[model samples]
Target: GGIITQTPKFLIGQEGQKLTLKCQQNFNHDTMYWYRQDSGKGLRLIYYSITENDLQKGDLSEGYDASREKKSSFSLTVTSAQKNEMAVFLCASSIMGFNYAEQFFGPGTRLTVL
Candidate 1:
């Protein structure tokens, strides 16, 4: 019955600037993830944490940073905002069930770089 929430529904940044996005979950789950979606493209994993304070970089983690201060929340930072860039960053959590844990996703953090 819990849900994930992303803050600052919309974000505007200047090119080359760093942007940070935040997420929080009440599912009390141990695993959390961050994904990014660009226009006309599928979601790409940017970061994931199996437990609090432990972070693992995803395939698309090259230009970002993630932090898991505690299980209830996670955050991501875009290293350098590209010119006129736009994307949606998502947050998700899983209960770590045996073999097949179900993960729930937050709406997303919409970003636009001018």
Candidate 2:
């Protein structure tokens, strides 16, 4: 059992700017994931990594990039932010099993692009 935290509780970005959000976990989980949650939509997976430095693109990965340089941390970058775009980015970690993995999530980082 461990805790997860996201840096910069709120993020403000400019149009076309590359904005990055960071997440760290003390859980030492083998798998990490990044997801985006819009105002009224369910969370959409952005990226995931099964091991350090291994990246797997997710449903919403076209406009984003992600990295897991260390087992304790994962980061997501918005390649080109869109004006007036707003979303919540969530970070999660889990010790994956063959079929079931219980994920623990961070508080979340809210993003606003002006």
Candidate 3:
């Protein structure tokens, strides 16, 4: 068993500022992911990394950037914060090389932009 941790549970950013969120997992999983949660929209994948320093952009990654420092850590950045925007960023991890590995999620980083 392992745990996923997100740093700075809350984030307050000014519009146009670049804000970053960090995540770390002790699960030693090979794959990590970042997703954005909107009020009405469902969870949208932002970025994923299959291995150390690898990157994959998702449907909603246009305005975001992600980095995988190693197999156990991943980080996300909001390129340009939007005004009055609120969203939650989630980090997840899954074992690789399996047919269908179940993913576990971290607490989440809540963002509020002014």
Candidate 1, residues 54-91, lDDT tens digits: the string is 99988999989999998899999998999988899999
TM-scores across all candidates?
0.95, 0.96, 0.95
- Could you give me the TM-score of model 1 versus the true structure? 0.95
* Candidate ordering by TM-score (highest first): 2, 3, 1
- Stretches of model 1 off by over 4 angstroms after superposition: 97-99
Residues 1-114, candidate 3, lDDT per residue (tens digit)?
A: 999999879999999999989999999999999999999898999998989999998889998999997788999999999999999999999988355889999999999999
**Candidate 2 lDDT over residue span 5-92, tens digit each:** 9988899999999999999999889999999999889899999999899999989999999989999999999999999999999999
Worst 10 residues of 2 by lDDT: 95-104
Local distance difference test, each candidate: 0.92, 0.92, 0.92
lDDT of 3: 0.92
